[model samples]
Target chain A: MSQVEELKSELTEKLGSDIQIKTEFGDDVLEISKDKVFEATEHFKSTGRYDFLMDVCSVDRQEREKRFDVVYHFYSSKDNRRLRMKAQLGENEKIKSITPIWKGANWFEREAYDMMGIQFEGHPYLKRLLTHHEFVGHPLRKDYDSNRQQHCSKAADLHFEDDETYVPDPNKDLIPLNIGPSHPATHGTLRIMAQLDGETIHRSNVELGFLHRCFEKMAETHEYNQIIPYTDRLNYCSAPMNNVGFCKTVERMLGVEIPPKAQAIRIILCELSRVIDHIVCIGANAVDLGALTSFFYLFNMRERVYSLFEKLCGARLTVSMTRVGGMANNPPEGWFDDVLETVATLRKGVDEIDRMLTNNKIWIERTKGVGGISSEEAIAFGFTGPCLRATGVNLDLRKANPYYGYDQLDFDVPYGTSGDVYDRYLVRIEEMKQSLKIVEQVAKNVPGGDFSIRDKDIVLPEKKDVYGNIEGLMNHFMLVIKGLQPPVGDIYDATEAANGELGFYLVSDGSKRPYRLKVRPPCFAIYQSFTQLINGGLLSDVISILGSLNVIAGELDR
Target chain B: MSTVPTVTRDLHAESEDLLTTAAYTTRFDKLVAWGRKNSLWPLPYGTACCGIELMSVMGPKYDLARFGAEVVRFSPRQSDLLVVAGTITEKMAPVLVHIYEQMLEPKYVLSMGACASSGGFYRAYHVLQGIDKVIPVDVYVPGCPPTPEAVLDGVMLLQKMIESNQPRPWKDNWKGPTQ
Candidate 1:
């Protein structure tokens, strides 16, 4: 038997007949009773496989007897296998907190509580996460009104309950400092409340929801194609990746395969996006450390990438460039030439930045050995992407899972020994070069043909054909009126985004719009460990650490 | 005796001209307004994607420094213009208002991007429909995260408003939007 099958049978025997086992979208799913959740999860963790808790979220089925399905996704770096466990609960029913087993589940559980109103019984500080403390209703619930507005009388009334008295240690003379929610260095809309002993931080807590645009809530009302624009706003730095990941999920449910040319174009766009994402991460990190020159150098290259995206999709930052079963459009004439020119310019800029920052004594002193986490702690906290790789874990989804023919491309996954701020910087810098290489290769080997699937239901006919041919006109009218309908099932699709694994867990009820859509943002997992990473570090190091993580508020609060 | 009489006449005439020029004062006002318009130090209240575009405006290509408004002061007290960029959620609305109130007199507010101008595409619960709901805005630049050039244009519009001596809502008895 295969590793997944062997594990599946073993889990079925161990968890009793109450568990229901099924395979959908090539993933093993275990539907367990609510009471046995903690026991089964603990058993799964103790087996030394499934070491990483990839994601934890809840899907609301308002009409069902059990109104919520709390889903848990786990990955085994040892055997490169993925397992999903879901426990169903009725309204007002409580589930045991998984934070005790995986510390990273803390935020996920709080988010579930905040969005769905499902309570986690033993979760410490199970309060509002992505909404204001005064927000009345759980937003992701199907019955929740999309247009309801909740207003606060004053900013003073917006304090967490624990903010009144909680302290890391009552004995120590620690000064409380409020870092942001508006400060420039905190990036978007993140607030850090830190307790400090002298200049060193004792403990810190992050406050999110400042930029919460309610993307998930918005996704419910939008059709599959209409939701593509909303996905662009998530992880806006690498927008094409979000577009592709969401499209791939829906396409998988529909079981439509995109043409080869479309896939190749997608590879180019995604890699270009990865390069842009790393530019922002590294450039912003360097700028936080008082190295402004590198930011200018890298941003010039980013501007070039934006121009390329503009040529492709007519917009720069929020490029909603992908469609289900294919891309929005074919590449314009001489697109390959533009890609090569941009990559060449980017290489020159990267070389210049390398000469200036790499091995610089001051940069090393500020970054090396600071805010470090061990591999064991990183895995437990569910760190992925470059941050986990910096701790010497070779768990890249692009290589292991090989989605979208990434296995056909040639690249290297750079890793580091010490998971410090410096190591993350190095990993991102190397990753940028590798992405550039991928873009170059894809640009050369890009196939020629249709940029979308041939199916009439899935792809819109050409405007000329629609205008002339009666059959084409009929097909166009039907598509415009009734959208593409996927099969009634659930699937989870993940892409190797610049930050890490960007997964989209989609549930369809044989409708044009999705029944439920959940995004497992890489930054959401990384930000949960922020307090641990910054604890005991100097106040200034917090900026460096946050920059290294590259936590975009759009994704974090979505 | 003849030279002395001529000097006395010239002194009396020159004193009369000086007094009239000082009393009129339109030229002095215009000069002061011109200086204020050119040397506008903006405090960028950059909160989201529009903030990135604002940064690009300051970069070498667009070169906001060429317009003489490149001195971006983080502190409200030091700035004469407030460039509110990106969406303002309810949680952040009070902070924006507080920053606006802290600015020195003769300050201008440039609402850059659709979000800051009118909450763009994010017309949902958490988002404050428009930043104008909290503080008065002098110029509204319309774009979903407007391009750097658009932001620069907004800055220019603010400079023109300052020169024209447009009546600021804050300067009047205008209370902000009611909840």
Candidate 2:
């Protein structure tokens, strides 16, 4: 039997037979009731089978009897199987919070409650996670007006029930410091409320919705093809990854396999994006640490990669270069030579940075023991990608569940000893070197063929064909005028983004636009543990920790 | 002399009227505008995708230091040119306003990227429709995260406005009959 079938059989034997497990799009989804959510999740944890809670997102079905369907993505580290648990909830009914089992579920549960108004009972600190406190109704619900924006004047006070005032006493030297919504160290809009007692952080709260631009709500209204550009903004550092990740989710729904050349392009661009993303992280982290020369070296290399992207697409930062069926266009002429040369130059830049910061005393002193997290705590917090690997976990989506033929690529996954800021920086450097190798390998052997798939219902006709002949014009009109529609179903797909696992859970109602699209941004889960990571660290360590995390506010809030 | 507008007369008399034998004669307001335009200290209010592009302008390739505006100030009090560099949502609007208000007078605002100019394509809830709803935008650079070149264009345009001493409704300046 398949592992999914084995899981179903095991679940049936352990629990009652009333639970229904069915194969949907090749993965087993266990349909459980509200009363059994906690018990089933506890079983998954206690048995040490599915030890990680990948994501928790809720879908709003306004026309159906069950107003919301809370979906849980559970993964077993030992067996490499993903089990989906779905529980239906009515309009006002509450689902049991899974935070007790998985501490990572705290922010996810709060996000569901804030966006779709789905209540998670017994969830501590269950206030608004994305939208501001002044938001009136749930914006993700179908009935909520998309244009009805609320103006938030005052800042929110996240006060506990039994909390005393923040006023510092004369005896103690404790004080509260607000870090950012506009501070330079935040890189963007992450705000941290840190209570410090003589340079060490005592307690803190993080507010990170300042860059939320309503990406999910916008996707619900746009067609599948139009939504690709919006995905580019999610992880702006790695635009092609978000594009390919979203398009792959839709491609899975359509059941179409892109050409080999297209897969090669996707892999090349994804790895290239990973290299640049890490460059930004390392460069910016060094800048925050007061070592300024490496930033110019790394950013100069980043600009070289940006030039390649400019050649492929027209834009630099937000390159929405992938379509649902395949890529928007092929790489420019002599692209392989350009890519090989760029990767070779990037290696030299990497070496220069290594010499600058690897053994430098100041760099080591600042980042060695700061923000250290154990492997168990990292897994419990749903850390993935480089951050998780920094804690000694070898869980990369590319190795575990390969997509877009990432399995065929020849590269090594870098692991670190302790999950500290230094480990993260080292991991990023090693990963960039691996990514350079992968880019070099793929650029030499790109399969040449059509860039789009064979599905007529999906890919738009070429521009020459559309303007040339009558048959092509009619075909183009049919596809572009009316958008591409998929069958009625929901699918969850993930890609190993530069930051971590970027998952897209898309539900289609057989319409041009998606019924719901939930982007499980890697930054969201990794950034949720900020307070834990920097609880006892010094004030200067906060900047280094935040930089090593590389939390993009767009993806975190969206 | 104030109403004179003949072509040759305007050029000949204008230069002669400003220069004396021993000293240079000019208005103090125009002097301050000249000083402000050439030496614009900028505070980057970067928040989203355009932020990377903003950093690109700060990078070595498209160096903003080529102009006299390379001194990036973190505190609002020290800066004169405010470059609003990304999307301004409703939650961030008040913060944007607070920063703009904190800057002293004679400060100019340059709205970079489409989101800062006209909300871009994010015309949904939680997004403030154009940052002009909260702060006075002097120049609008138009791009979905505009290129560094475009951002520089906006900054140069703000310099021109500052040089010409454009009408400041918020400031008490007298130039016309109504004044």
Per-candidate TM equals 0.94, 0.94
Candidate 2 CAPRI-style tier: acceptable
Candidate 1 lDDT by residue in tens digits, A1-558: 976567667867887665567888888888888888887889878887788898889999888999999999987877777788899999989999989988989999999999999899888789888777678989888888766768755553323335755644556657778777767688748888888889998777788888887788778788888899889878878889899999998888888888889898888989898888888888888888999888777778888988998898788888887888798788889999999988999888887877888899989999999889999998888889999999999889889888778899999999999999999989988988899999899898888888988678787787888999999999999987888788888888888888898999998898878888999999999998888889889999999999999998888887
DockQ of predictions, in order shown = 0.43, 0.43
- Tens-digit lDDT track for model 1 on B127-173? 88888777877788988778887888888887777777777756476
Question: Which docking class does model 1 fall in?
Answer: acceptable
Question: Candidate 1 at A228: error in angstroms?
Answer: 1.1
> On residues A1-558, what C-alpha lDDT tens digit does candidate 2 reach at each position?
977677777777877788688878876799998888998998898888898898998999898998889999988878777888999999989999999889999899988998998889888767887888788889999999888888888656533223434554557646868888888889758888877888998888888789889999999989999999899999888889999999999999888898998998999899999999998889889988888788778889889999999988989989999998998887788988999999999999898998999999999999998898999999899999999999999988898888777788888999898999999999999999999999999899988898888566898888888899887888888888778999998898899999999999999999999999999989899998898888887899899999999998878886
What's candidate 2's DockQ score?
0.43
Candidate 2 runs further than 4 Å off = A157-173, B1-27, B170-179
> Which stretches of model 1 miss by more than 4 angstroms?
A2-5, A156-173, B1-26, B169-173
Model 2 TM-score, all chains together:
0.94
lDDT of 2 at A177: 81
